[model samples]
Target: MEETVANFSGSNGPDNISGTPGADFIIGLDGNDTLFGLGGHDRIVGSGGLDFLVGGDGLDTIFGEDGDDTIQGSAGADRLSGGTGADRIFGGDDGDLVFGDEGNDTIGGDDGNDTLNAGDGDDRVLGGDGDDEMFGGGNADLLRGGLGNDLAFGETGNDTVFGDAGNDRLKGNEGDDSVNGGTGNDSIFGDEGHDTLRGDDGNDKIWGGDNNDVLYGEGGQDILWGNDGTDSLSGGDGNDQAYGGGGSDSLYGDAGDDSLYGDAGNDQLFAGDGNDLAFGGAGDDFFQGHDGNDTLKGQDGNDTMFGGTGLDLLLGGAGNDTLAGNEDADLLRGEAGDDDLNGGSGDDYLNGGTGEDQVTGGAGNDSIYGEEDADRLVGGDGDDFVRGGAGDDVVLGNEGNDTLRGDDGNDALIGGADDDMLSGGNGNDELQGGDGDDTLLGGDGNDTLSGGEGNNELTGGEGADQFNFDGGITTIVDLDLDLDVLDTSSVLGLDTALSILGSTTVVGADLDILGGDGSLLTLKDVTILDFADFLGIDIDLLNSDLGIISG
Candidate 1:
């Protein structure tokens, strides 16, 4: 065994010292010295100044103490440390343990599965091209896993971590950080402050821990969670799963068919370009669906949702929500609370479940139902089917051949254009049929039926029924004329009957008795006995309150 100590000072030329092949000791002190332990369980030390320490062919220990240093453990199971100053430490060829104890250091495990620990200051640690483990101890650090399945931890301060190619686990334990899980199915965590995490190209699991964070699931079917604070997450390409956990967060399902959730706080979710399903679990949230057929639910709080350019399903689950189906065929449900629902430009279906609501069938053939409370429903242009479920409702079938029903509750129903059917089902209702020959059926209770401005049919079913005649062109047929009344208040210009026979037509004369428009009336299913009150009089005197013809 041999021992040698070589000291070089005063900014001189570098000194290179080596030991014998047996167990030996070599040390270099100051002034850019190089220390080498060439064989047999040797120990080499480089203390102060720019130094280099190398351990060769043995289970040796090497240390580069202070100033910019480089320490390499070559060809043996070695221990290498760069203690203080900006240093570079390499664990070469064997399973070695390496450390960059201080300063901003760059540390790598060259071959063998090794452990690289970057203890403090801003540092870079790489499990170099092997299935190794690395730790970023403190300060802002960069921890990368190379070519193998690795485990990386960014313990504190702002850090950047990459799981370069294999299945790796990257954890950012504290401070605002950036993490990338590259290529493999990795698991990543941003433990505390605001963070940015990417599950790049793998079916990875990425979690944004605390504070406001941003996460991206870039390729495979990944799972991302924005655990706290207001965060933004995107499922970039595959059919991924994302969640906004508490805080006001934003989640996007981009490209693939995805499932997203807003668990709490007021959040926003976008189902971008793919058929996706999104749920707004609590708080006030907003949801948007673009291009593909998607399904969205605003589960609680006052939320708004828009289904843009796709045949989507939108649900306003609770609280007062607004849902709009912007393009293709859609289905919308306002489950609880007072809601406003719009079906834009497609054949849509809308239901207002409870509370006072308003629904519009915008530009397509839509079916709208007011399932509870007082609701207002408008069937915009197409042949729509609109029905009012419970509370006092108002329904309007604006265009095309449509059907409007006010089921239960005191409702008002209007069939606006084209040949349509309007039914006031139960309760004291008001039904008005406008334009192109409609059928107005007032089902029950003290109902008022007006057949407005068209050759229409009016059938008043039960209770004190009032058949109103504006006389544009109308037909009033009371099954039991002995129990129904013909309201002649606005029918002052009504005509004397052209003919009246049993179960035959009673056509209009349009006689200008009083001052209203000269319109026609066809009273069917009645005999002359039904009109006994104005019998044998001129058509000018048809202005009396004819109550059931005094049966």
Candidate 2:
């Protein structure tokens, strides 16, 4: 067990040799051996045996070959390799190049910048300090880039990789792998197979390259992309950006302001807290803005989106999409295709931008607009204002004291069971007052106003307008005496000219036309003598249709 001063060589049997203080070269050949180059720049080789080799000082090179070996580069910049068998290799100080060549091995780059490779077999490797580069081979491996800025790759097999500290780049290349960027800004890639990747701290960028992968950005602002297959990604904190590149993927922005893009396939994105922006780029996708004011766009295909807990903007970009604003005041736009939009709660704005869309203001006082084509706009609850901007649209005031307008084309404005106002702005439109006392305004062109079951006021602004009544007291104002007509064909009495003339009476300053079923139509600011020529009682048609009135 005594130390040797000269460069020594071991025999084929088990031997122990320790070298000189100056630069020493020690070789262990065959059998199990222990070789130590104790000082200065040294070269130590354990050839063809299960051995323990150590390069103690200065810049050294140590190699453990042909058997299970333990190789240590104890000081200075060194080169170490455990070759051929299950080995444990360590680079103790300064910069080093360490390799675990074969079998299940454990390699550690203890200090300084190093390059470590776990070549073949299942291995465990760590880059202890300084900036380091580590590589894992074809079997299950555990690779850690510890401290400083580092780079690591888990190549093939199911591997676990960690970028422990400082800024690092980590990749899980093949098979099902797990990768974590423990601290500092990092970049992680789940390259192949179904993998799990996490950005534990600082701002990080992560990519799920192929197959179905799971990714998380645990802290700081992060960028995550689910590149292929069906993947799941979560941005745990800070403002983040997430992309679902292909296949059906799920992305979550757990906190802070976030933006999520569903690029292709049917993806689901949740912007959890913060004011976020989300886009369903292609294919049918789903989006949820869990909190804060968010903007969600269904860019293509049929997408469904929900804006939760804040003022949100939801757009149905293309295909037959569906959008809903779940809470607070929101804006919903059906941009293209036939879309359905709902403003779930609070005061909201809903616009059916194009194609035949269906828009609903779910609660609170809301403003709904049917922008183009034939759309159906509904004011779900509270006092709402609705406008059918173009095409033959249907505007319904569902509840409360609502206002509905038909801006263009032959639209239908229905006041559903509330004290409402219906306006026909242009073209030949139909306005129906469903229940409570309502007001109808025919702005231009020929229009039909029907006061369904309540006392109503009708104003025919221009063109030949028709007023239809169903019970209750109805008043007609701004009626062009010679152009507007009242169809009283549904009356029980007033079938003959004598009976129709007897029912016409002057009630206060208004001219009242009475029906047999206790219904009355009042012509405001007109005398019975002046309106008699506009009535059809004195004329008889060729078909003996007594209700025909020529205006």
* Candidate 2: tens digits of C-alpha lDDT, residues 149-181: 999999989999999999999999999999999
- The digit string of per-residue lDDT tens for model 1 on 149-213 reads 99999998999999999999899989999999999999999999999999999899999999999
Alpha-carbon lDDT of model 2: 0.85
The segments of candidate 2 whose C-alpha lies over 4 angstroms from its true place after superposition are 1-6, 489-551
> What are the Cα lDDT values of the candidates?
0.84, 0.85
Instruction: List, in order, the clash count of every candidate structure.
Output: 0, 0
RMSD of 1: 4.6
TM per candidate = 0.89, 0.89
Measured by lDDT, the strongest candidate is 2
Stretches of model 1 off by over 4 angstroms after superposition: 1-15, 479-481, 494-551
